[model samples]
Target: MSKLSIKPLADRVVVEPAAAEEKTAFGIIIPDTAKEKPQKGIIVAVGNGKKDEPLTVQVGDTVLYGKYSGTEIAIEGKDYLIMRESDIFAVL
Candidate 1:
Protein backbone atom coordinates (compact mmCIF):
# COMPACT_ATOMS: atom_id res chain seq x y z
CA MET A 1 0.00 0.00 0.00
CA SER A 2 1.14 3.49 -0.72
CA LYS A 3 1.31 5.98 2.11
CA LEU A 4 0.22 9.56 1.79
CA SER A 5 2.12 12.46 3.28
CA ILE A 6 -0.63 15.02 3.27
CA LYS A 7 -0.30 17.42 6.13
CA PRO A 8 -3.28 18.89 7.90
CA LEU A 9 -3.91 22.57 8.25
CA ALA A 10 -4.34 24.44 11.51
CA ASP A 11 -4.29 22.51 14.77
CA ARG A 12 -4.57 18.95 13.52
CA VAL A 13 -2.49 15.81 13.88
CA VAL A 14 -2.30 12.42 12.21
CA VAL A 15 -1.76 9.61 14.66
CA GLU A 16 -1.42 5.95 14.06
CA PRO A 17 -2.47 4.11 17.18
CA ALA A 18 -0.56 0.98 18.05
CA ALA A 19 -2.60 -2.17 18.10
CA ALA A 20 -3.46 -3.74 21.43
CA GLU A 21 -2.38 -7.24 22.30
CA GLU A 22 -4.84 -10.03 22.17
CA LYS A 23 -4.95 -11.60 25.64
CA THR A 24 -7.10 -11.49 28.68
CA ALA A 25 -5.86 -10.68 32.16
CA PHE A 26 -6.17 -14.39 32.88
CA GLY A 27 -4.15 -15.15 29.76
CA ILE A 28 -7.15 -16.62 27.98
CA ILE A 29 -6.29 -14.63 24.85
CA ILE A 30 -9.85 -13.78 23.98
CA PRO A 31 -10.53 -13.07 20.34
CA ASP A 32 -12.20 -9.82 21.28
CA THR A 33 -9.18 -8.76 23.24
CA ALA A 34 -6.99 -9.35 20.27
CA LYS A 35 -9.29 -7.34 18.09
CA GLU A 36 -9.42 -4.39 20.43
CA LYS A 37 -7.57 -1.24 19.39
CA PRO A 38 -4.80 0.28 21.41
CA GLN A 39 -5.19 3.66 23.03
CA LYS A 40 -1.63 4.72 22.51
CA GLY A 41 -0.05 5.81 19.26
CA ILE A 42 2.84 7.66 17.72
CA ILE A 43 2.59 10.87 15.77
CA VAL A 44 2.98 9.91 12.17
CA ALA A 45 1.87 13.06 10.39
CA VAL A 46 1.33 16.57 11.62
CA GLY A 47 -0.44 19.65 10.35
CA ASN A 48 1.18 22.68 8.80
CA GLY A 49 0.93 23.95 12.37
CA LYS A 50 -1.02 26.71 13.96
CA LYS A 51 -1.30 29.59 11.57
CA ASP A 52 0.85 32.43 12.80
CA GLU A 53 0.87 30.69 16.20
CA PRO A 54 3.42 28.63 18.08
CA LEU A 55 3.00 24.95 18.80
CA THR A 56 4.64 22.82 21.46
CA VAL A 57 4.57 19.49 19.64
CA GLN A 58 5.83 18.09 16.36
CA VAL A 59 5.83 15.06 14.13
CA GLY A 60 7.21 11.76 15.50
CA ASP A 61 6.17 12.69 18.99
CA THR A 62 4.15 10.30 21.15
CA VAL A 63 1.17 11.72 22.95
CA LEU A 64 -1.46 10.88 25.50
CA TYR A 65 -5.05 11.17 24.27
CA GLY A 66 -8.42 11.65 25.78
CA LYS A 67 -10.75 8.68 25.58
CA TYR A 68 -13.12 10.55 23.28
CA SER A 69 -10.76 12.75 21.40
CA GLY A 70 -10.15 12.52 17.65
CA THR A 71 -11.73 11.05 14.56
CA GLU A 72 -10.92 7.54 13.43
CA ILE A 73 -9.70 6.93 9.91
CA ALA A 74 -8.47 3.99 7.90
CA ILE A 75 -6.01 4.54 5.12
CA GLU A 76 -4.26 1.91 3.04
CA GLY A 77 -5.06 -0.76 5.66
CA LYS A 78 -3.69 1.34 8.50
CA ASP A 79 -5.63 2.96 11.32
CA TYR A 80 -5.08 6.57 12.18
CA LEU A 81 -6.40 9.26 14.43
CA ILE A 82 -7.19 12.79 13.28
CA MET A 83 -7.63 15.13 16.16
CA ARG A 84 -7.36 18.76 16.96
CA GLU A 85 -4.05 19.77 18.41
CA SER A 86 -5.85 20.96 21.50
CA ASP A 87 -7.34 17.51 22.01
CA ILE A 88 -3.93 16.14 22.83
CA PHE A 89 -3.77 15.63 26.57
CA ALA A 90 -0.04 15.33 26.98
CA VAL A 91 3.17 14.49 25.19
CA LEU A 92 5.23 11.54 26.31
Candidate 2:
Protein backbone atom coordinates (compact mmCIF):
# COMPACT_ATOMS: atom_id res chain seq x y z
CA MET A 1 0.00 0.00 0.00
CA SER A 2 1.07 3.57 -0.67
CA LYS A 3 1.66 5.87 2.29
CA LEU A 4 0.68 9.52 2.74
CA SER A 5 3.34 12.25 2.98
CA ILE A 6 1.67 15.42 4.17
CA LYS A 7 2.30 17.12 7.47
CA PRO A 8 -0.52 18.80 9.39
CA LEU A 9 -0.28 22.18 11.05
CA ALA A 10 -0.52 23.32 14.65
CA ASP A 11 -2.51 21.10 16.97
CA ARG A 12 -3.06 18.33 14.45
CA VAL A 13 -1.74 14.80 13.94
CA VAL A 14 -2.30 11.70 11.86
CA VAL A 15 -2.61 8.28 13.44
CA GLU A 16 -3.32 4.63 12.65
CA PRO A 17 -4.41 2.05 15.19
CA ALA A 18 -3.37 -1.54 15.61
CA ALA A 19 -5.70 -4.09 14.04
CA ALA A 20 -8.84 -5.15 15.89
CA GLU A 21 -8.51 -8.93 15.63
CA GLU A 22 -5.54 -9.00 17.96
CA LYS A 23 -5.29 -11.54 20.77
CA THR A 24 -5.45 -10.79 24.48
CA ALA A 25 -2.67 -11.07 27.05
CA PHE A 26 -4.07 -14.41 28.23
CA GLY A 27 -4.31 -15.72 24.65
CA ILE A 28 -8.03 -15.07 24.51
CA ILE A 29 -9.51 -14.25 21.15
CA ILE A 30 -11.57 -11.20 21.95
CA PRO A 31 -14.98 -11.19 20.39
CA ASP A 32 -15.91 -8.06 18.53
CA THR A 33 -18.57 -7.23 21.09
CA ALA A 34 -16.08 -7.57 23.91
CA LYS A 35 -13.61 -5.14 22.39
CA GLU A 36 -13.52 -1.43 22.93
CA LYS A 37 -12.20 1.04 20.41
CA PRO A 38 -8.45 1.17 20.78
CA GLN A 39 -7.10 4.52 21.84
CA LYS A 40 -3.52 3.65 21.02
CA GLY A 41 -2.03 4.62 17.67
CA ILE A 42 1.20 5.57 15.99
CA ILE A 43 1.72 9.01 14.60
CA VAL A 44 2.16 8.72 10.89
CA ALA A 45 2.23 12.43 10.15
CA VAL A 46 2.85 15.38 12.39
CA GLY A 47 2.15 19.10 12.24
CA ASN A 48 4.64 21.88 11.42
CA GLY A 49 5.86 21.79 14.98
CA LYS A 50 2.73 23.40 16.46
CA LYS A 51 3.15 27.05 15.49
CA ASP A 52 5.98 28.51 17.58
CA GLU A 53 5.39 26.06 20.41
CA PRO A 54 8.19 23.54 20.79
CA LEU A 55 7.02 20.35 19.13
CA THR A 56 6.29 17.68 21.67
CA VAL A 57 6.56 14.84 19.19
CA GLN A 58 7.33 13.81 15.66
CA VAL A 59 6.48 11.16 13.10
CA GLY A 60 6.70 7.55 14.37
CA ASP A 61 5.69 8.47 17.89
CA THR A 62 3.09 6.25 19.53
CA VAL A 63 0.33 8.12 21.26
CA LEU A 64 -2.70 7.70 23.45
CA TYR A 65 -5.65 9.54 21.99
CA GLY A 66 -9.05 10.54 23.21
CA LYS A 67 -11.92 8.09 22.68
CA TYR A 68 -13.48 10.37 20.07
CA SER A 69 -10.38 12.01 18.72
CA GLY A 70 -9.85 12.83 15.07
CA THR A 71 -11.55 12.66 11.71
CA GLU A 72 -10.83 9.65 9.56
CA ILE A 73 -9.33 9.82 6.10
CA ALA A 74 -8.26 7.34 3.47
CA ILE A 75 -5.36 8.36 1.33
CA GLU A 76 -3.98 6.20 -1.45
CA GLY A 77 -6.07 3.28 -0.14
CA LYS A 78 -4.63 3.46 3.36
CA ASP A 79 -6.43 4.72 6.46
CA TYR A 80 -5.26 7.61 8.60
CA LEU A 81 -6.49 10.01 11.27
CA ILE A 82 -6.41 13.80 11.66
CA MET A 83 -6.84 15.44 15.02
CA ARG A 84 -5.78 18.31 17.22
CA GLU A 85 -2.60 17.91 19.24
CA SER A 86 -4.66 18.43 22.34
CA ASP A 87 -6.67 15.36 21.44
CA ILE A 88 -3.58 13.26 22.06
CA PHE A 89 -3.66 12.25 25.70
CA ALA A 90 -0.02 11.21 25.99
CA VAL A 91 3.08 10.02 24.21
CA LEU A 92 4.07 6.43 24.80
Backbone atom clashes (below 3 Å) for every candidate: 1, 1
Q: Rate the local accuracy (lDDT) of all candidates.
A: 0.68, 0.71
lDDT (Cα, tens digit) per residue for candidate 1, span 1-92: 23466676677888876556465333433233444332556777777667687567777776767656798987777778898878777766
Best-matching candidate per TM-score: 2
Model 2 pairs in collision: 11-85
RMSD in angstroms between candidate 2 and the native structure over all alpha carbons: 4.3
Q: lDDT score, residue 58, model 1?
A: 77
Residue lDDT tens for model 2, 3-61: 46776877687888645546743353434465454377778887775547856866788
